[model samples]
Target: MKITIWPAGILAIIFFISTSCKQNAPHEDAAEPAFVAHPVAVPKQDVMTLEIGKAAPDFRLPDVNGKFVSLSDFDEAKVLVIIFHCNHCPTAQAYEDRMIDFTNEYKEKGVDLVAIMPNSAMGLLPEECGYTDLNDSFEEMKIRYEYKKYNFPYLYDGDNQSIAIAYGPVATPHAFVFDKERKLQYSGRIDGVEKPGGANAEDLRAAVDALLAGKPVETPVNKVFGCTTKWAWKSEYGKKVEEKWNAQPSTISRLDEDGIMALVKNPTEKLRLINIWATWCAPCVMEYPELVALQRWYGHRNFEFVSLSADNPEHQDRALAFLEKTHSPVQNFIYAGTDKYKLIEAVDPKWDGALPYTLLVEPGGKVVYSSQGPVDLLELKRAIVEHPLMGRYY
Candidate 1:
């Protein structure tokens, strides 16, 4: 007899058979049924956005090299995967390796993977960028693209975000897969795992494999969880964060040689970032704002940024004024001693007594990172986040 098993009917029969077999079987402790039917919860998709089987939207966005890349460019590929990702999101950063591996593995099979940065810098707050060294600006996109050595075309849609709007990506690292006819076959995350070094891009790979074999995707859509996409309209909210930061009172205190030594000792449990700069130092003044931004970024964690000015004790007013102008809300101090050598020795014995000296000290006063010249903010941020105490993700 030819039997046609409907989904519900099959589930009921499996349940009945398993129950009956368990009750009558000689081995009462026999293992449960090899296969059990569990209802799959489908993730909700935006009603107005691209639906399953809908044609992929056309987009002409600039790549890292300033060349415009469009959907039609991948027409020859049997499968196309477009990932809406950004530079700042930790989740996106974690999946970078997987995306690269997926691209390299599938390229030989007529598959193309393209990444589009779809965040507006205006909508991203400094605190939101706490987990990353780079923000979602187009220029930063180029930096990330080159630094990460992405195997796929990395495009920028941050200017207007019109392309992002059409795709309706709810989060960074959201993936959309299209077949040869440009019909969307899958739309969700690259995998079920959120943290780095977990599952490979199994969900995405499954969709691609099915489409390549001229078969429908078994699971076309799944829930995507990551940093929310920074839409341009959210700039108003970003302004509020800036206003609150600026409203905080900027104050500077006098730090003698003893005080500087104590600060360097770092008795507290937090990671202390000590920056020794002077108001007269041009590079110090130029990079002060970024230092303030770094404080704001990692301030919530077990981290503190302390600024020690090497300006003359008599120039306290000038130093304080500069701090106020830069909206520095961190612990600010100016050396109160006439001898600059004492200040230098107190901060670090191995110091060359260079202006704009920066160092990261652990709780027990172990210096993890030290820079003598103008600090590279990106390098500093990486050192901070990658430390044992702080991580890219929880």
Candidate 2:
């Protein structure tokens, strides 16, 4: 929803109108909505191995085309190449173009390259999503496939992830090659290069060449390097990272009506951004990292970003620790009164008591921007840079 700043806000309507002129561009709205993935628990995939001389696992899985594909799908192919991959990993993205090129080049030599997304969508974390344009969700995989126009078969194994566990891929872009008779010939990385530009697919190329020549692969198993498969246990890892972050010293002070009103009034000369969030708000937590990043980006530009937690007084320390974990480098507050309504109305009547509410106030206490829930980061960036108060600094 487009927010209308209160009349008391400086140049309220005019500010929106004028800023809209410079801020609203056709392409800005073209950005895809950010996908927030939830976490779920399941028995973690135990260590498993496909012995070097053992037959490659044969199973049927749905391809991007909605058709079921299996190991036997590649007919008359002298070699089958199964690559455990996903859309989110930087390592996987870095190798996408290279993977496509390799498949095209090798297809002429009877080599079939089939890609599979190995992580459950529920297991994907937003913190792990910043590095890529897409997540590991099935919908995201389809979007990515259409966007990249990948020539090889891209399948989904995230439902049960049985194939992934069977092959035991440590990371995305982990390659598993099978000879004409479907024997596991090579298992490891697609290349020696991680960053991609100047590096060649040396390791994988050698393995494939040797097998095609009817010889043993010189390196049967090369170590793989990439983002760990987003197993269910990764959710616990996120909690641990948050715990480590919160372990640092942090301060969370009580915020009374007078103090809250004072903060909202923007007594200081800097543009003040007041954000109301809660420890239990999933959307808020998902957005915390980006909020911290914004502060780092615009802190020197005379912008002050303050956070107010609606968490109960008894849990103030928890809120403070969360702020610290998020690397919050600004004023932090906790609702002080027993009456939550007083604090809510005092903060912003238009807020309707939302968990994650943000308002950017001009130096004179006039709000220029207000939003609730998770914000489209693109517009958030534009709002900060194009505001009259911040334009000069930009």
Candidate 3:
């Protein structure tokens, strides 16, 4: 009779039948029932990255706990789950809770989990890190681990991604299951779903159980789908995006004290980020490139970004040239007033006239954030994305 093979039901039946036949039959070949389910095809990246049915390559990566973890160290386990995970990818973040559950479910049953960060932080840019709080860096991983209280060992391999290369993880949430001999058994996603708690960890769980029960995994090489492993060469991709936005025409306009106060008061229908910088200020020049990236990423939404030049009134041409060269995509202005103190106070009375200052102003001129120095780009985005008024737009 043809049967649909569910992991739990098929395993239970196979266990009963195999045990009964062993108890009654002689020590000769007694034909046992075999449950066959077609395995998923491997992805192109996996074919290039890892060898199937081979001994797992050994690794000694440092975990978030400050201890070194090697693959061979877990030889005591009947089956080990090696996951290529990272802190940034939303797909990886979504699977965190389920990954914890999967490990806890089988920890005492001679099964264990080791998660590897497969992307290099050097390859990561701030724009590629918009979804999560933590970057894929080891230090950020520690912060995430402590904050999340993960049950399994999270190893950092991103400095080189050598282990990631050896195992061939195509995506952040990809996994590989190995039997006691440390031979690769299954490699792919933990489940088919990409969202948090979307699918049961059936693929991974089934493979682990099968190996523990002395049965081969039914689906050995399912394809993984998530953020690609960020190789070092991909670092330039973010720069290209920045360059594209910078290539667009940059324009500047004159704003008198009344007009400048209007932008500060945010008469327009959007959240405005006002930056006070001068062409000659070193700190302002240093922060301009990142601010340009931010303008490109969020300027299309219900948000606005502009730079106000603190340059002298006669130096308006110099300020305009700087704005164009820096690729400030939004509207730009030159302070048209004589009193610098009045202008700084008009923006915010709590002001010390400082170069490279910033303010995130809500509609109707409510000042949400005011900074006297170069803004921390990552932290600034996080604050805006998490704010009650601005979160929904993102």
Q: Note the Cα lDDT for every prediction shown.
A: 0.86, 0.78, 0.78
Error of 2 at 159 (Å): 1.7
Tens digits of per-residue lDDT for model 1 on 226-290? 99877767777878888898899989999888888899999999999999898889999998888
Instruction: Give candidate 2's whole-model lDDT.
Output: 0.78
lDDT of 3 by residue, 66-178 (tens): 67788788988988889999987878887888889988889989898989887765567655664665678877888878777899999887665667768878888898888
Q: How does model 1 score by TM-score?
A: 0.86
By TM-score, highest first, what's the ranking? 1, 3, 2
Error of 3 at 379 (Å): 3.1
